[model samples]
Target: MSGIEELDEDRLGALAHKLDRPLVLIGLMGTGKSTIGRRIAGMLGLDFVDADDEIVHASQRSISEIFDEFGEDYFREGERRVIARLMTENKGVIATGGGAFVNDETRALILKQGIAIWLDCDIDTLVERTSRRNTRPLLKQGGPREILTRLKEERSGAYSRAQVHVVTGDLPHHETAMQVLEALEKWL
Candidate 1:
C-alpha cells in the first residue's frame, strides 16, 4: 500500500475519536479548504459542510448573484448568519468562504463554537490554483496573484488566530488533509 493509504488506515480511528468539536477551515479561495475539509471529515467519520454552499442554500441564490444583487456587505452579513447557524446545528468539518474569517463576528463565532484550522498556502500556489476558475468575484478586479497577495496581507492575521495552522502546498488533497489531522492532533 501507498504511504497515504497506510496513514489513513492507521490513523482513522484515533482521529475520529479525537474530534470533540467542529473543525472549521479558514484560508484563501484556492487553498483547498473544501477539498481538504471533505477528506478530513471522511477520515473522521463526520459530515463535511461548505459554509458558502450553506449560504447559497439558505439564500436560495448563487454567491455571485447575491454579491451582484445585494452588494458585498449584504452578502457578508448573510454569510455570517449562515455560518453561525451551521455551527449551532452541525458537528463536523466546515469549509468557510475565504472572507468569512475576516469578519470579526464570524471569527468570534467560529472561535467559540469550533476549532478553526488555517490552511496556509503560498501566493504562487494560490494563484495557480485559483487561475483554473474565473468565478471568483474578487479576482475580477485584479490579477489572481495580486488579489491573493493583498488578501493574504489583510487576512493572515485573522487566520493566524485559528487553533491549528497547517501549511499546504501542491500536494494531493489527502496528503494535505493528513497534515491538517496532524496539526489538529497536536492542538487537541
Candidate 2:
C-alpha cells in the first residue's frame, strides 16, 4: 500500500496478519500515537489499547488524578505495570504513554516483547497539537515549550531505541496511520 487509496480495510487486515504481533508506538505526548494507533487497529481489524487508558482503567482514575494524588513516581510505576501487561498480549496496537519508554525497566519490557515504533514529531508540531488538549498534566506544570524540552531531553534516547521510526510532521491523521502501516510492511 503506497497511499490513501491503497489503505482499504482488506489491505490493512492483510498487513496485520502478516505482522501477527503487537505493535507498540513510542513518542512524546500529542505526536498522534493514540490517534494513529487507533487508526491502525481499525484498519487491521485489531484491538487498540492506549497505555494511559489502561492505567486509568487499572487505577479507576484519570492520569492527572493519579499524579496529583500519588505523584509522578507512583504514576510511572503504574504505567510500567500497565504497559507490561499490554505488551504481552495478542496482536494489537498499543499506544504507550509518553514517559513509558523513558523508564529503563519499561523500555526493556517493551523491546523484549514487541516491536517499537518511534512516532517522530517536530517540537513546533507537537506544541500546536498538544495545545488544544488540557488533559496533559506535565505540560500544565509550566510553559508548554519548557515542559516539551524537559520531556524531549529525558525521553529522546528511549524513542531512538525503537526498531522503526516514522517522522510525522503536520500530516493528516489517516496519512500518518498509513505511514506506520507502510513502515511495518517490510517487517511483516
Q: List TM-scores for all candidates, in order.
A: 0.93, 0.91
Extract clashing residue pairs from model 1.
none
lDDT of 2 at 20: 51
lDDT at 58, model 2: 84
Query: How well is each residue in 40-128 modelled by candidate 2, as lDDT tens digits?
Result: 88878788989898898888999999989999999999899888878777568999989888899998988888889999888888899
Best by lDDT: 1
Q: Give stretches of model 2 more than 4 Å off.
A: 1-11
Shift of residue 151 alpha carbon in model 1, Å:
0.4
Off by over 4 Å in 1: 1-10
**What clash count goes with each model?**
0, 0
Compared with the true structure, all predictions reach lDDT values of 0.88, 0.86
**Pairing residues by index, what is the TM-score of model 2?**
0.91
- Residue lDDT tens for model 1, 1-188: 13444555557778777677799999999999998999888888899999998888888998888888888999999999989988987789999999999999999999999999999999999988998988788888877788899999999999999999988889888788877787787677
In candidate 2, the residue pairs with backbone N, CA or C atoms under 3 Å apart (3 or more residues apart, or in different chains) clash, namely none
